[model samples]
Target: MLSHLNNFLPRQSSLLMKCNFSKMFCFQCEQTINGKGCTAKGKCGKTAEVSALQDLLIEQLKHLNSVVHHAKENDVKPVTTYSDHFNLEGLFATLTNVNFDEKRFQKYLHKGEKLIETYLKNGGEKLKSVLHENGIQTADFSYSKPLKELIKTGKEFQIDLTEEKRPVTFTKELIMYGLKGGAAYLDHARLLGYEDTSLYHYLSEALQKLSLPVSEFSLESLLEFALQTGNWNLSCMELLNRANTESYGHPEITTVSTTPVDGKCILVSGHDLRDLKLLLEQTDGMGINVYTHGEMLPGNSYPELKKYSHLKGNYGGAWQDQVTEFAKFPGPILMTTNCLVPPPKKYSKRVFTRSSVGYENLKHIEGDDFSELIKVAKKEKGFKNTKKLALKDIIVGFGMNQTLALADLIIDAVKEGAIKHFFLIGGCDGAEKERNYFEKLAEKTPKDTVILTLACGKYRFNKKDLGVIEFKGNKIPRVLDVGQCNDAYSAIQIALALANAFDTDVNSLPLSFAISWFEQKAVSILLTLLHLGIKNIFLGPALPAFIDPSVLDVLVKLFGIRPIGDVDEDLKLMLKN
Candidate 1:
């Protein structure tokens, strides 16, 4: 796919030469070009133009947020419905691998300018006075320049140039990344008609803070704000949890097939349940099998979704493997959210992006109308027959509600020594060889311990038959799939319930987090853990490149967060503790 992206290269190279800028500077994910940054084409296939445009979009959002913040402080509430949704969508579009279409960022940039105008117009005199009193001049949100000029302007706002102090810049990126993750959750909830004004308010406040000069805040103060971002992300995740469950019923323990059945089919990837539900509704009884990929695997566990017999089963693993898996998938594909890899030409025409997901050449579904997507599915040659595979099935759907239903059994087993410890061995998975640490650690976990897994990271060892733990004739699966990264709230609920049952704090319980992070959502989840004061988390394959050494030291001292070491040593330490 990247080799075919040469058409974008000449223009990108010209932009770099004219502006005297590096090709790009993005290190927003674990798989950046190097451990430092992507100074050429992005490892995720984002062109330099799109990368810079996204940076400009972020700066534009910060300026809009600053205006909204002052308007609210002056007792004027700007129309929130549009601004809130736009802010989230704008931020979400910038997440790694979410959107690579320069045109989409250009559209978002124009929309952001309009939103800022609306807020300023609604703010009137009182808001103007507040802005003047604070010496906070509003930014000119004009984005009418040519694409090349706009890309050059965007270079001025790159992460590296955001703050003079490295630690301050790094901390700011941390908060910004957390906001991006939180926005993803909030956006999902909003799509389901669940709205939290407080979460929206926090987003504006945080973005407003980011717009300020580094001299206005200390590293310690910024660090505190990062935790606050985490606290709000918890609330955002809670909102999404309610939206998903109340709308689709809490996920029940389900055994989903890894093989496909004979029929025309459509594969839905990414993390949006609402889009999946809509697609399912549209495809009912159409003889088209709807299979899930990546984080969408948990959709098979939803009562509303699984009821449809045509909703076949998952057909692929994590997002990282989509390049190979998607090509083999004999149907149209719908990417509804983040973690989208650029598709190769072989299946690029068969792929379509919906919601915030975008790739320049792929077709995009607008709104709830998946008619075009369904049409392509019907035209494509889907699986002629089910392929035989060693891993035929996997169990999922152990959400908070489902897990809580088995609370008595779990607690009794723990007391009876059938279960010794709980290991949270999941997060965002990547293509790095170091990620094998998660698989090895899971494989080595004692039978007396139960492993809770979620997100794409679970693809590391989810297929491995870890068997079950039996207590007084009651058998519990050794591994529990706790849904998507969006379902982290469910895992947190399980932990809180267990802590209450054991009469101890979560840190005191025999629970260890061996998190494998790849993107911004993982960063947000980490902040939530830190906000809860959860300690001794083992994070890998590598820490965020944006985290300055000094800022990392602060996190290490404050949160007891450490990098994953040898699997044997880490497992021994976790078990011994």
Candidate 2:
């Protein structure tokens, strides 16, 4: 009788995939090593090959970093140093679901080939020669003797260079993923003509240091990187702010729709503002109406974007609901980033991905090319608008800059007890049922409080019939949609404004943060909040599976980062304590 190999296999394989780079370490992403990595492929379907390629990308980036640092110090000043090289749109492709094209990866592989010439122009030739000789390009990690470990474990607060392969841990990959999102966001802003050379430099340094082997540094040293990331994130947001304002105008306070218009329409989701602008331009007079979906809902608040004649109302609900909404809608959908849950088979062909968003067999729009959207819309016979009851019109454009300008009114509300509390009830939306905790908390909160929100989290209570309260002679409702989760940058601003007005530290203010997170973007925002020394923040519905027990302890101990409990209990806890 043939033996069942399955019986021989470990029911739950835990072995890390052998590193293709130096074979010195095993894959920490743990998704591709002969069923050893997580017992299944990763959520993004990253394989051992992709993991190795990613490491090589990091290795090349570090080589570039060494050159950039050396050249900057010695005044070598190469033409295409790490700053420009690292910011390629390729970084966006590496983010989960950003890109899945094998063809595209090959193109990037070629791009990686050219990167060495650029690095050579800068400062690290010795490293470049070793990189060339090392069979990393053809054979992934044949040199398992030692890995050129970047950010070594236990060294915590240090960035270093080494040829020793440090073991890759799950947390290390998670951190790398966060850095990738930040780097990608920073890159897009640079592409938009908004320049922050310092951020570009820091991003490269950060990316290079992510997995590098290092010696040691204190908590203070680790905080330095986190703060530096914060500083750069500030720079990124500023750059994005400038780019958005210049391209689409500063989002003015305006009401958007949960209801779709009755006629042919298109729903655009994700945060690619440039792609949105391109869509507006293309569909302007084409009889095809455009509607913002998910993060794209804020696009309607930007003045220039709103001016698009064909830009109609929003469609459906949060991204998690898109599988059903997009299926029912008789139109094409354009997704620019994550918040992409796989659409059902029926509506698959009608969707198009721009930038890093990809799904197998779906037509993905690339480059500055948004033409695919127009063609798909034509083929789909335009949208049969599915309209729902209109919710009360609520304002959206309270971005950090704009909200701070309204600090006086907000301050007055708190002083007069017009608003007893400020609840930062926002975060990424997911299909998980546990997310109902957000809405439950919202319902349970006092009527005298204000719901300050951003991102897809607003989908929970944005349509609720909360009566408007007269604060400062202006009748304002409890809820405010402050753009996307990245605009938690705005939430922080509003808090600082209230604190400054009240003359107390931000934590001392009667403000509570209850967030729902499902992805790395949310993870980065949480990290940003922690970096700011904010406390008593409640996260839900579950902490990331990647966070080890030790790391979770540190988070809870240092920041009081509690996971969401029962709504009644959490609300009472927040109110009483």
Candidate 3:
């Protein structure tokens, strides 16, 4: 199918080169229409030029990584940080709805090229072999050129699908998406001062492999790369799990308020708890309050972070509702990481980005100093009075440590037929109305069943009264909040413990996964599940746009991956099976 589209590339490329840009072919996120690639514009409001610049930036990352790989093979010390930094930021920038600024991507591409030039200039005979090994036919030692002149050459680096089959391309994209997601998690861990040099080494090697010609790689090789992506993502998750728990202590089971306080306030969103910790520290005794929003809601569960009195509670739902929610938020909002949508004019001035997150005309904070945000918060009319969005507090912090402690009771309840099944239903959430399916499924789940949820997806039904069950004189909440998306590691741990207790594999247990994915982090999580041999996962609101029909068929046959059916029917199917 992709080859057929490339038949007109001869004419298309000519026209694109003349215009100094080309059409984009992106379907990285779940919102892609009809599950086909977006040609003219991205569903997330990204333009062709921005997508092209992102691809160009990734291409340069590949080049930078190949240089490092070549240098390492030749036993030469290289400025590997050049490649390492880009590997983290560049891939993160390409995540769905993360960065839409063409100029930012252009700067990254230029910086990446200069880093490559430095490698070539410093490298000798060993560098030559390195370049050859990375599929570079020739080398130019010149680094003095206008940034535009170099950026214009980026069109030559755009992804071409004439040679590779669509399924293979889809698999490659799947693997790359997983790596991008893993890199985002790794970045968070790095911010907390955790480092894994071996993981970084494998990451560069994988990026270098992406630089090789498509014709040289086979489907089998692509499959292996996808599996390796899962392996690396597992390590990345483990590293983050350690970093988060060691720094913040294991998450404790607690109820978080969904209300606003009567004072000047700052709303901190995204997945970074370290930023939240910093903001909470600075805001302490300042007469201003701090609140969590979106994925940051789980921050309320961490023992270290939750100790702050100013850390009030969660503000909004998921990232999709930010446009309307941020405006209603009277105080300043700080987006510390990904899942940022362009703010509306009404609230654009109130939104600030930090760390790899960026948008045009928005203030970008460089460090822990959130004074600007504080000033803005002081100026705005914050919650004039305390108002509760929910009468009852939402439960959170049911991580592996907390869940495993109840293993004996859970097992005994299962034996006594008090607990029927466990459904792990959560991941990234989106704006699609079809996502209501998750809400319905969760609402309809039996009272005797326990629902394990994580990430922003839990917001769809977290506020509901799912009721509690009593078994063997122990009380267990029906819905368990398993921390943030990264805490899917906790879910994995709980599953393993349960499987071990039952003397069976995870797939054989009375457990099911009904996952909702909107972006690459969900992709990484799904790959990790596959790597663990878990099967029959029901994924929606829609399958990824990047997957070809044939490729999806292969996944279904091998892994029992299925799309969500009607809420009632799917719930019944999960319980019956």
Candidate 4:
């Protein structure tokens, strides 16, 4: 049965068959151990067993996607809601640091197999014949195999990294990662009642191509598909933007206190605004003060969420700090999405996960009902007294709407040389010491320059008093927080609007990007930049391990993408250009 499965599965194109099997293989993030694949265990604390299970889940999802793709192509009504949402959650679960429970992956595997069965049953004989003719197997596969057997089967599907197959493997991984990011954003939008069937079809088609043999595509074609993933990601991000802004009024420049108030508290982490909104609604007047952590810090800027007086200020810094931060917190923590680190046993009992987030021994919230979470908060002692920090508050909510509202002032400042340059110095933040480069870059920018930031990376220097640039009696913050990583759409809109005001293109403007990426969402945003013909993006602290020399060369030559260097040198170069 294993051999039969291997016959139908996509294989790498390589002449050398020498195999050096490791315990596990994964290199989907910037911090993969030793700048290569993780073998013994994931740096994110994922075990080899969990890694294998995730790989297997992806393989099974590809098979299911093939059925959905062919059904749509053959004019059979595909199960849009089930298949699309399942695909989103399945891929998102495999992203770095999202889900770490082995049992959860097992359940996902079973659910995917059942989804394939449902799609085939709905398509009837005509759909099955169409799929079979296209070399897709419609036969049912058992996910009910024993745990050991399933793990063994999963190990057989580790990514192909042969020297001869690097280019193809790199391009395929790029597309897959972008799709994962897109799926994450789409899922957020879906939760807010925004759905685009075309986006769903595109995802199914892309996954189908990914399941095909390497020989079926050239490097050029795969690269094109990867860029298309970026193009669709732009649409996905726009959809999410609308879903967020429409559901909650557009974010405004608001001051959020970093200090905790005296009351029962719940620290809401991750990037889901909808989750935060729901929690805020449920916890209102319950004496539970909700504090934003990690990417949720931006939630305080939205009008609808801010209306809940109990929605207190932000708590910890970036996601990487959760282990220590979560331990010291006075109450329970709710992890709404990615960037979750495995909690130590000390505080594991106080942590709860929702949606696609999961950990082995921690409690999971099934739906909008955070009753148990609130109950846990009520049992725990909240902050006995308010504590003040050196930085009392930080300003956020410089999204498109807020920024464009000051367009005339910004344009006049630039024209008068009051604001000399614009720097977009933000992306996913990591624990690496080198990531400090972004902080330094932001700090060293000339006082005349404006810095635009998003995602958790802003936490690096968000509290710094960069001072405001005053022009024509108007004060504009030198450091502007443009919301979450998904809010890159707002950053792009700001740039386009500025370009139009200047009567030129974005490239011709005095704007530059120094991106600090650590995950797939950053990859999707990078691809979107490349799709827009943007150039000279400085990416760091390290390049992706999957991008071999050849692929890196293509990116450098085509998009002028460069790796981060000495902070002084990069800053000088950007200012000089």
* Candidate closest to the true structure, highest TM-score: 4
Deviating ranges (above 4 Å) for candidate 1: 1-21, 124-141, 161-164, 387-391
lDDT scores in order: 0.87, 0.63, 0.81, 0.88
RMSD of each predicted structure: 6.0, 8.0, 4.7, 5.8
Ordering by lDDT: 4, 1, 3, 2
Give the better candidate number (2 or 4) by TM-score: 4
Clashing pairs in 3: none
- TM-score: model 4 vs. ground truth: 0.95
Please, what are the lDDT tens digits per residue for candidate 1 over residues 1-577? 2332233234222312222245678878888754667777889898888888998899888887888888876777667788889988999999988998988888888888887777767887667777867776655436867778889988777554433477887788899999999999999999899998888988988898899978888899999999999999999999999999999999999999988888899999999999999999999989999999999999999999999999888888999899999999888999999889988899999989987899988999887899999899989988884565545698999999999999999999989888999999999998999999999999999989999999999999999989899888888999999999999999999999999999999999989999999899999999999999998899888767778766766777787777787899889889876
In candidate 1, where is summed lDDT lowest over 10 consecutive residues?
11-20
User: Pairs clashing in candidate 1?
Assistant: none
| Full ranking by TM-score | 4, 1, 3, 2
Candidate 2 local lDDT, 1-577, one digit each (tens): 0121123223122222232232223222212233233222344454434444444555555555554544455555455533464444556666654555544554554565455455455535554444446322322322122222321211122211122312224345445556665766665566566766766777666765653443433333454565456555655665676777777777778776555565566778888777788888877787888888888878888888888878876777787678788887768888887656666679988888876666567887657766666776766665443455554554678777677766778778878888788889998776567789998888778888888889888888777876566875797668777897656666777887788788888788888999887655666676677777888888776655454444455566777877787788788767753
- Preferred candidate (TM-score higher): 1 or 2: 1
At residue 137, give the lDDT of candidate 3. 41
The lowest-lDDT stretch of 10 consecutive residues in candidate 4 is: 6-15
TM-score of each: 0.94, 0.81, 0.93, 0.95
Under the 3 Å rule for N, CA and C atoms, how many clashes does model 1 have? 0
Off by over 4 Å in 4: 1-19, 124-126, 387-390
